[model samples]
Target: MSTDTSARWRLRAHAALGALVAALPAWASAAPRFADYPVPAIYQGRAAQPLLADAHSRNYATRLRDAATEKPDFAGRYVLATWGCGASCTMSAAIDAKTGTVTWLPFTVCCWDADVEDHLEYKLNSRLLIVHGARNEQGGGTHYYQFNGKRFAEIRTPPRHAPHPPGDHQ
Candidate 1:
């Protein structure tokens, strides 16, 4: 082959190789896998059994709703769990009556193995906000948030309290 032809062929090969490398990350991110984590030992520990047992034995949804609405000074909390696609997850939420401060703990099982990118947003003066899930092994998810009477911007920072299970609802 001529030298100029050979050189052009090599340049095209290098360009093709570079393009393939650049496309790799985008392709990898397009699909992800979610792996379930072992249930927390706290749920199995002696001291924690009673608490877990109580949770298993009772349904407190009605009581929670009542407190949030009936009592002006009520600070309410609850946990909810569900099973899906052979896995289960939970979400919890709490609110302070006096300061109107809210806290939540959101988690999933068998959803993803990647970094947990949970973002919570609360409106400045309103109780409505949005929660965004980071790229997990399970792809990604988003949650619509609302607060008591007030609409507020969502805050990405962690809240002091860890919400249980039920509060994961959008």
Candidate 2:
């Protein structure tokens, strides 16, 4: 090919490569991969037995490995795992530090906040776990839960106000 023709071809190739590289991050982020973050050994070691005993737990265990977002050392002795089952549906499980016991919390509906992109929050140095969920058409609210030696149980009254718009309130 002539010099001008070859130069044009090279420019087009460079542009195509640049476009592909630029699109990679968006493509990768479109689906969150749980495998990217493996469950910690503390939880993984004890999860096999209980997970194998029941089919549902086994499925959840797989999903946990595939999609769950883990917070290690949560509450000083527990590793908290959260994953989305579907739109607005979420599930959580906790691994006890002392016993390695995995406790699966009830499946919660409308637990996702599209605005903030998170469903769970924990207070520093406090045992309170605030779970956000939709209450009605107006908005969503938070339910406070406390780990009561056995499981996380809802304590104290939930927030009464509607969920403020993102950036309006935190």
Which numbered prediction scores highest in lDDT against the true structure?
2
List, residue by residue over 1-170, the lDDT tens digit for candidate 2: 99999999999999999999999866643321223222333333333222334565677766545322343445545666666666666677765545545677654637445565556765323455666675322345655566653677765433445343342122
Model 1: per-residue Cα lDDT at residue 91: 37
TM-score: which candidate is best? 2
Instruction: Give the Cα lDDT of each candidate.
Output: 0.35, 0.54
- Where does the lowest 10-residue lDDT sum fall in candidate 1? 41-50
Model 1: residues with Cα > 4 Å off, grouped in runs = 32-170
Local accuracy of candidate 1 as per-residue lDDT tens digits, 106-144 = 333344323434344332233334444422224445443
What does the lDDT come to for candidate 2? 0.54
